[model samples]
Target: MYEFRELAKDVYAFLQPPLVWYSNAGVIVGDKDVIVVDSLANAAMTKNLLSEIRRVTDKPIRFLINTHSHADHVYTNHLFPEATVITTHSGREQTKANLELQGEHSASYAKFFPEFDFSGGRYTVQDMCFRGTFSLYQGAREVRVIELGAGHSESDVVVYLPSEKIAFCGDVFLKGMPPLPLEGHVSQTIAHYKLLESFEAEVYVPGHGEAGTLAHVRVQREQLERQFERARECFQKGMSYDEALRAFAGDVIPLEFQRVVILASYCEFTGRHPETKDPASQSHMSLIQSVADELRVLLGTKEVDKKVAMSR
Candidate 1:
């Protein structure tokens, strides 16, 4: 079941009912008004969040702040038609494009998940869009929404509540899961993380996973930096994309995730191309050769299980 937990006196987070993936929604309630961070993936789930908010206060929900333009983050935005929806200018464009794309293809995607229905529904675009910093005041409290340009997505925004020392960071950081670098550049992502570290928020709310501290965010930042640096080193050494893919893949880690990351990294490093030979194929091959050689050396010193587990 979906449940909402109060993270602070005026902050509340809701865990979406577990499905294939988990997502979170948050609310910042002031004495006179409230603001919702992101809408859930579907109408029913978003309605549940609205119900929860109604339970705590009768104050109207004045703002719907979208962190990015991902379908899961803004799909149910139409539910809050009365609220002024706000997001980065790029996010607004992406959201409009995504909605049109989803409306045309969501039925096909829904076939993969027979449990949920995706019919003639549509998402609402942001009413207000900004390029840099935007602020909104609810009674005496001020909420600052800042766009940290092109990190996780082209329009990633972090909402900060200075009075409470709390931040609702969108998909820029996740707690436990290795961040999915699908629509992002590694360098920009790293810079975004560094900017986040500079903030003095006591509580950090992620778009996914549990709420955490600045230390946790720092660790994730470091992990991404390491991954990108390693990938770049391999690329600089004349390693093909496929060679790099195989160098990292093994029986220990799932092949699908590895392939996706390798391909995504290749696109980030070399730029996407349809006519050129598949660079990922070459990188994958090199990766396999490197891993095999490393394994052989480790086998002489440790058990196979220990060696395999240590790779990650």
Candidate 2:
């Protein structure tokens, strides 16, 4: 489930639940036109987002700004025919490439996301590709889309409103959860956090989870620094990636992500990219067992589900 929340007078955040692979977006309504920060994962969610925007105001959507090239954010770009899609040059290229790859292997996704319907999904890359920073105005309101390179992905951008003091930070800053910086370096993630803090924005709409303040950003940054330091110590001790992952003990939300992050950090420390071994080449039974084990830990059993339901 998702909620359309107003962060300020005319600024809104399309916040999704804290489920893995779910993303959040933003809406900036101006005098004549509107700007959508990012799109949703599937056709249904994107259509729902469009309906929410129409409910707010009848202003035409002029721009769909993609914060990164991840399929969860850019997969539904084709739905907004009236809007011009925007992202960084690298973001556009990677989006195009990844979309092609996804199309080639569309069947594999169902094994993971059974809820999302990806059938008949059309891929749409950004129309306008900028290098560093691009600013646009909807009548008098200025929206700044700046590319903070190679953090969570090859190209990460933030949509900022100076007057409103609100920023739509993409996956680089996840509220109350760990960021998957698998495609980027830990050092870059730290620098990006510092840059985000410098904005001094009163409201921050993250790529996932709820909308929060600067304090959330600071907390995430501090957590990442501490995790990286621990990973570094493990690396220095000549521990393998798998050993390091098991060594970093915590009961964090989405503990599986912490395992992957530890793998990425250890790989970087060893001066190599995280190995992308094809599961298809491995033993199918073992692979299935491994996935089941991770899922069991992540989603929990019936008792945990009942507890969550009762809390809700």
Candidate 3:
């Protein structure tokens, strides 16, 4: 009912409402069956998504393809028990690790944002795994799933429909949101952009935010390059992370976005996450910096870690 739009033919995208994880899902109506790109955050969200799918198409959903293994994108895998769940080998492993890791921190996270929920024990792992490329055929339609590598995560992939000229890009091409450097390699992310472009798809659906075109992807790619360069410039100038943060916060995007870039830069330059992870532990400055970097990336809020100021 909100902003679900058809990208091409019978292909559709479900844009997440703001209060949720701000993720999106893609739906493809095959000749005789249906293929789902990703699931929503939890049971309730999946239920809502399923209702929307039913509204547009009555064909049976034969396959559930996860672009990646992020909890927001794959937590509802259990709901589609009838369909085969698909992901890359690394994606499946990361999904399992993510489930365990998220479960461990859900309590602390819930305390911060009450909307955080994954229905407790309601997650399904991948039923089928692929190494690099996989394809599915339903009636006359064909869908291609290609692994672009561990750019956003350990293993990131995108779904492309050759006939429709549409690509269901996961978090690999965030629109307004800051491009997360989870793998600590923004350069690899640039290369993945080329991979996505190679598809020659007219329409691109990002896992988060709105659906856009290759031009949008190109702009974001340029922004990512500049963001990386700016971070490096700040570091090379011997500016503290805070100084660099202030030098750019609200300069291009929002402070939250700047923090994401700074966090990524710190993680990339340091070659490791701050050794001390707990924010309240008053751990080493490195740990405090690392924790703040991680927190800003996880939650895009204006809150800054005051302790980071003490490092100066």
Candidate 4:
């Protein structure tokens, strides 16, 4: 399920149910055309989004700005055939690489979720790619798409409406969900939050969860700070990745997500990727996989779907 919110005059948000892979999107209606913030996870969801968009205005979608290269956000890019898709150069490259791994991802996800299907889905990369800030005017409204280095992903960007003080911050800010430092570092994610707060937007639409104010941004920031501090302290004590995970094992955050953040923080401080030749990092990655498998055994489809339904 999803909720459509009219954030401001001509500015709208499509908030998806809070769960893994589900993402929020936005629509900006211009005088003659329209612009979309990000695409949803799959084909069905994107179709629903398009239907809601048509209900508001039948103007041609001039541009579709992607916030990052995550599968959930970019999988349905092909849906908007006429619109020019925009994303960071790194994002486009990542999307191309990720496309190759879709089969593996689908197979793995199928083991845990048989109903979540990706068959018959088409993927798309950005038509226009840039390194830094890209600004365009939608009639008179200034829509600024700013790439905030790396945060939730290597291609993280925030779509800000300067005149209206509304920002569509991608995975950089998740209101109810824990921010996954999936392909990025904790330090950078924390830094990006500070920069987002500096925007002082009256309304901030996160990549997931409902649109909120700066206060929501701050709360999420504080959680990141706490997790980072704990992880750092464990690292300073020369604790192994497993030891560090055990240290924060009692955290209220879901173990599946908390472990990833812990591993990410560990990698950030050590300056190494799990896929690197480093033995320690490889072991950390193995631990993450073990925990994931354990989680799958514990929470079956019914429990996971129940959680998703409750999130709505």
Deviating ranges (above 4 Å) for candidate 3: 18-20, 116-121, 274-312
Candidate 4, residue 133: lDDT: 92
Per-residue lDDT of 1-312 in model 1, one digit per residue for the tens? 556888778788876421222357889898777899988776666667889999999888888999998766887788887788999999999888876776454754464344344432466788989988978887777889999887667768899888888888887877644554555366777878888888867888888767889999999888777667767777788888666765776745444434434555667877772122544334423333333334334334345334223221
Give the least accurate 10-residue stretch of model 3, judged by summed lDDT.
Answer: 303-312
Q: Report how far residue 144 has shifted in candidate 2, in Å.
A: 0.9
Highest-TM-score candidate: 4
What's model 2's TM-score?
A: 0.86
Q: Lowest summed-lDDT stretch of 10 residues in model 1?
A: 303-312
Task: Mark the 10 consecutive residues where model 2 has the least summed lDDT.
Answer: 280-289
Q: Write the per-residue lDDT of candidate 4 for residues 174-233, one digit (tens) a residue.
A: 876776676648888888899889999999998877788999998888888898888889
Q: Which one is best on lDDT?
A: 4
Query: What does candidate 2's lDDT look like per residue over 179-296, in tens digits?
Result: 6665638878888999999999998888877787899898888888887888889878987666665676564534455654565576577667444353411332233334334544
* Model 3, residue 32: C-alpha shift (Å): 3.0
Shift of residue 128 alpha carbon in model 2, Å: 1.1
TM-score per prediction, in order, is: 0.81, 0.86, 0.82, 0.87
Ranked candidates, highest lDDT first: 4, 2, 3, 1
Cα lDDT for residue 264, candidate 1: 52
lDDT of every model, 2 decimals: 0.70, 0.75, 0.72, 0.79
Ranking by TM-score: 4, 2, 3, 1
RMSD to true structure for each model, in Å: 8.6, 4.4, 7.2, 3.9
